[model samples]
Target: MAMESTPNIVGVDLFCGAGGLTHGLVRGGINVKAGVDLDPSCRYPFEENNEAVFLERDVNDLSPEALAPYLEQGDFSLLAGCAPCQPFSSYSQSGRSKKRGMDWQLVSNFGRLVQGLQPDLVTMENVSQLAGHKVFEDFLGYLKGYTVRWSVVECIKVGIPQSRRRLVLLASKLGAQGLELEYDPAVPARTVRDEIENLPPIAAGEQHSQDPLHIACSLSEMNLKRIKASKPGGTWRDWDPELVAPCHRKESGSTYPSVYGRMEWDVPAPTITTQCFGYGNGRFGHPVQDRAISLREAAMLQTFPQSYKFAPDDETIRFNRLGRLIGNAVPVRLGEVIGKTLVNHVRMTQGEIAVPSPAHHGRLF
Candidate 1:
């Protein structure tokens, strides 16, 4: 674990929204040098928290030659990209052709960059469903030169307090490294109450004066009544038939019960989505509170540290902007797991640590 003996891994995160992966990588022993994203708003949090350069340019605009400076600085370089995954999400899957035209191509672009730059290590995280697409297959083909490990990991299993699943991959040029993520069997899964229940109480539609991000969206008069009657883990079905939305009276809406439901305090929450701050969006209502989860709660559910600042003190907390950033982020804890896996692979490959026997070698194929 001594720093001097291990090969230096300088990471450059691509499509690095809000520097979530970069923060976790740094914690897991990788030196993240810079993060590149098209959103200019990401610059503050990326640079301020991680102390790394934030490039406000599209990944498509940058070429391998431009990234070589970061690659050249260390004995090893890591490039991680979690392309915008909406195109591959279940929400987009109903009755649509799986042959997506452009979004999947971003994964190809990531592959092209890796092919050209040949970073010593590479990683990617995305929706678990992406694995079935040809784009993912092609991306994997591009990495045939490296030892690659991939898995669909339950974020909760890795200590993220949400029932999120992500496709994680780790690749190394080093042979037989077999970079498998080892989940701790004994660690208890985190829950909603564990991560957010203790934050200073804020009334429905009220912002905590001291913490701007800890504000709730105002509820509609009917929605306020709905949430008040909602029980933890209960759906709108629990409400009196008269209180049910007219839409739910139709057969099509009967299947969509999770909307406007309260999250159970004891369980990991439903995946924190872009509209998670709204009272009627998914099952985001607070367990005992009368409001939907706040921006701060959403961020914390994604496992961003409590003190992690997404905006300057004077900036007004815009819910949609902050929600998109938090929802799109790779959970920091999951990134740490990938970082640690790569570090272990490097150490084992370089003989700094003994490789596991063939019987014990864990591979994520």
Candidate 2:
């Protein structure tokens, strides 16, 4: 239904998680052929929601020859991905260090794919910190054939409710494409309340009365008591010294209160962490309710439709797994914007459809 507005290119998503980017591609009018992810759990959601094939395998282990048939040869193919950004995540409190693991090298694996497939166009999204990382820079340099455009972008300026910043890169082999994107430097930031103020409310650890996806995590009795004592936008220090968790009372616990506290209804919520459904996680407490926000609610704030489905094994919804999937997805709307931009770039670069001769009529630009 979203594709009615435009159509042209075909795309394949690498490292697709819950089909967020893929959903945006379809909405922007591209025909998505398939999604590849090493996790089999992502298969049902990726394929069902986006209407594409899903191949389950480790990316590095797969060869271009095995991938050739799935790829479009000369029909303006786009290879897009947002590899895991945990290594570059700023909130990683473990101190200054580099991680050596399969996840860390996933970006290089992506570069390897580009070197082999050499898709007509490419796009990627990751933490803004990635801009400063050696791996990301090397990946960009490895794109020896394509012209690339990129910027570190804030999600609020683009309608995502969180204050999330991501590095967005667009590249095309057909010369250079415009890299400029507009954002309001002076615009007021979006608060969590601004996004989900009108949704039905529920207690901690309870599902909304009407929506199955509106799932919440239950809090322990003591934690519930602690949360009730917490003020909106305030820290656990607000509580009596006796109420403070022993860890928070210790030097190591000072940084954790912003999380155990309630969210201010008028202010934007903190960045949605993987543990968003838990009150003790981040500032995830509902501004007015006793419990943390629901999974469906979090997805809605992220701009995913209410009906977006993630079940693959037909098992009961696992809150931990579900939250991780939704939290990790690319915001679909942002993806749509990039998709539209790519469409415009492709049309203009090829000049296949241009201003018609006066005799032929110039109805479409």
Candidate 3:
């Protein structure tokens, strides 16, 4: 018996914000050729850390003709499209009717490219809420011949130190068995302490002298008082009557208790959001520090490497910009899992390795 040659897995990432998914794919041994996105800010980080070409173009305008050349360079081509998740995110569900802008169509556009190019493999990651949307079903309709597997994945289950849940999909044209992301129950879920507790502390409105991204946003005098009163794992309910915000005093605001809170160090942090730099946003307050989590801490919680650079040296690190970039990224650890799964699936299909029994690994259906 002779062993077969395994194909080299190559990938092109669409909507590749700050190269988080690309970095994880590289870490998982895929040879990523390029990443495409509309944001020019992503160019520096995507190219700097991943050693891949960064195309500054909107995903909707990208045609298969433009991307086919990159896929042609490898034996097993992969297309990854983790479009901006805001349209399907729970945060925007309240205003969904008014806010259903251009982003809502980007996932369908991804489906267009997948159908047109007919790549060997395809993967997408987005907020779990996307699964409930009609767009997800429409996207699935486009995959006429591919075997698909997808599920809502808990970030901590994959070692990411955040209580985030995302929908992950894998589609393959190769064989009947298809592909699924593997989760091992024996792997301990990571905690906030494991990811960022060792970093030198910085007060509100201060930048770490050594690392620029470690800078925290400035707090107002009143917010300073509110954060000081905040206890880890506790909400605004812990504050004294005088310290409570007028909004919270209103009957409508009473339901929103996760705000103005601190994260417990022993557990995973809450989902890092676009407003994660604000202490009043969600449970973003630092456990013991009298400030919100710094831009770097948020990035680390998103599973980006501490050394991951978000901007050019000459560029200013504005809270809103960096916060949106870090928050919108797919946790790198999840991307690695997707990458490794694709590699193993290809090898097993090629007869280069034995496929594990279904009982050996957890499956996401």
Candidate 4:
């Protein structure tokens, strides 16, 4: 049988940070037209690495009319809205009040665009914890006429070298069915060693001569001792009692053992958080190196290409800002999974690919 030409599915990314999802979508064969984000820092990386324009506008200010120009260019349209997941993350829910403020409403803003535009396809990625919230149910209400499927996807299952998990949603207005991300169990899982072992070694507080982003943050004299005693995949319990922080001596701090820990080289890394560059944050310490992982290492673990540029050489590399961008991004490998699913879904609807049994359609795995 003659294979039909692949459809031209153009996409616009909402809350696109550093073009992670956009880059992955492009790799999966989707033509991303533009990436929209409020951060001006995202512009350089978004445009430099991918064939997309960067729109530095708040998603709250975006209207269907604003996206019309881009949507008109493709045979099928995709609106990807990966709202900031902090408000719905487990870290926020642990002890804080659940306030429905500006951050929480960003998901609603995404729904508004979907309601107004009624695009051919829509996708959303967020912390898996969001699936239990009322806000998530309300977001589903916006997809009344479309076939929807959502599930918590393990990043490692899709070739990401991190222990991160995210909720992924795919909805289609076309008659296609059985939408789910494809994963290959036969494929070997990537590891921290695979991602960063080859990079030139540098001491704590030293920057790699060739790669600016490969610089590690400086450690205090005490932290240097603590890290020196740390073992791969081990917790603070391995530390000498004198090196233990006063906070960890408290009863409540006993519950937080993963902090001030080191990663294991043979396995995937912990979920990269906004403070992943700090040794005291999660299990972010390098398996062998006495310092925390570098910004480049964090980005690479998020499955971003090693060559991905975060900023211009002339600008100073701010650790906090770059960490936030890299941490909050959807793993590029997962985005590629989404893009491939969307492209295959479109082909099924167009009769270019065989549609799966209806019994498997519309499942919420």
Residue 156: error of model 3 in Å?
1.2
lDDT per residue as tens, model 1, 237-303:
9998888999998999999999999999999999998789987879999999899999999989988
Model 4 RMSD in angstroms: 3.8
In TM-score terms, which candidate is top?
A: 3
Error of 2 at 290 (Å): 0.5
Q: What is the lDDT of residue 180 in candidate 1?
A: 81
| Per-residue accuracy of model 2 over 165-205 as CA lDDT, tens digit each | 88888888876533334333555766777777877877776
Location of the lowest summed lDDT over 10 successive residues in candidate 4: 90-99
Query: What's the C-alpha lDDT at position 158 in model 4?
Result: 81
- Give per-residue CA lDDT, model 3, range 1-365, as digits (tens): 67655468888999887899999988877889999977776788889888889997767778999999989898899999786655444222331222445366778889999999999999999878888888899999988899889999887888899988899999998864538888887778899999999999999999887888998989999999999999999999998999999989999998999998999999999999988999988999999999999999999999999999988666788887677778888889999998888888898777687878767687765
Please provide, for model 4 over 175-249, each residue's C-alpha lDDT reduced to its tens digit, 9 standing for 90 to 100: 545477776566788999999898888888988877888989999999999999999999999988999999999
- Candidate 1 vs candidate 4, lDDT winner: 4
lDDT of every model, 2 decimals: 0.84, 0.73, 0.86, 0.85
Which residue pairs in candidate 4 collide? Answer: none
Task: For model 3, state the Cα shift of residue 47 in Å.
Answer: 1.1
Give the Cα error of residue 96 in candidate 3, in Å: 18
Off by over 4 Å in 2: 1-7, 85-103, 182-190, 312-314, 352-365
Stretches of candidate 3 off by over 4 Å are: 1-6, 89-103, 176-178, 357-360
Off-target runs (Cα >4 Å) in candidate 1 are 1-6, 89-102, 355-365
